[model samples]
Target: MTIERAVPAFAGFMILLSVALTHWVSPYFVWLTVFVGANLFQFAFTKFCPAALVFKVTELKSAGQS
Candidate 1:
């Protein structure tokens, strides 16, 4: 998949993983959930997600780029 699609797909997977960890692993995992949510919120405005950077380094073209 392109970077555009991969970024959000990875984020959704991480959010779900954090939620599951919070429920089954430890309550402190809730902090991960909060972090991911906040990161997503800020990314909407900043458009500078670290994951996107990684995707770029890996040479994944965005849909628009293609």
Candidate 2:
């Protein structure tokens, strides 16, 4: 998948994983979900996604690219 798609997909995966961890492991894992949500919120305006940068290194295209 392209970087644009991969970033949100990874974020969603992280959120679900964090929720599961919180439920089955420790409540502290909920902080992970909070963090992910915060990042997404900030990214909406900043457009500075670290995951996107990582995906870029892997040469993934953005939306409508390639």
Candidate 3:
């Protein structure tokens, strides 16, 4: 998938996975959800996402970059 799609898919998957881990694994997993949320919040202002960077390096095109 393109970076534009993968980014949000990754975020959503992480959020769900963290929640599941928190419920079935450990309470500490909640921190992962918080971290993901924080990163998403930061990206709104910074316009930078580490996942996006990784996706770029892997040659996943952005929405319009194709």
Candidate 4:
């Protein structure tokens, strides 16, 4: 899938995984939720998302091949 689609899916999966960990594993996992949430929030405000950067780099390399 494209990076546009992967970012949201990754975020959602992270959230769900964090929640599951908090309930079944350890409270420390909740920290992951906080971290991921903060990153996403910052990305929204800055319009600078790491996942997008990764996507762009990957696309560039692939395009350079052909």
Q: How many backbone clashes does candidate 2 have?
A: 0
lDDT of 4 by residue, 1-66 (tens): 666676778889989999999999999999999988998999888977786687777773333343
- TM agreement with the true structure for every prediction: 0.89, 0.91, 0.92, 0.74
lDDT of 3 by residue, 11-65 (tens): 9999999999999999999999999999999999998999899888999887887
lDDT of residue 16 for candidate 4 = 97
**lDDT scores in order:** 0.89, 0.93, 0.94, 0.81
Per-model tally of clashing residue pairs: 0, 0, 0, 0
TM-score of 4: 0.74
Provide the global lDDT of candidate 4 against the true structure: 0.81
TM-score of 2: 0.91
Off by over 4 Å in 3: none
Q: lDDT: which is higher, 3 or 4?
A: 3
Query: Taking the tens digit of each residue's C-alpha lDDT, what string does model 1 give over 1-66?
Result: 898899889989998998999899999998988888888899999988989899899999988885
Highest TM-score against the true fold, candidate: 3
Off by over 4 Å in 2: none
Flag the better candidate by TM-score, 1 or 4: 1
Writing each residue's lDDT as its tens digit, candidate 2 over 1-66 gives 888789999999999999999999999999999999999999999989988889999999888776
Model 2, CA-based lDDT: 0.93
Which residue pairs collide in model 3, if any?
Answer: none
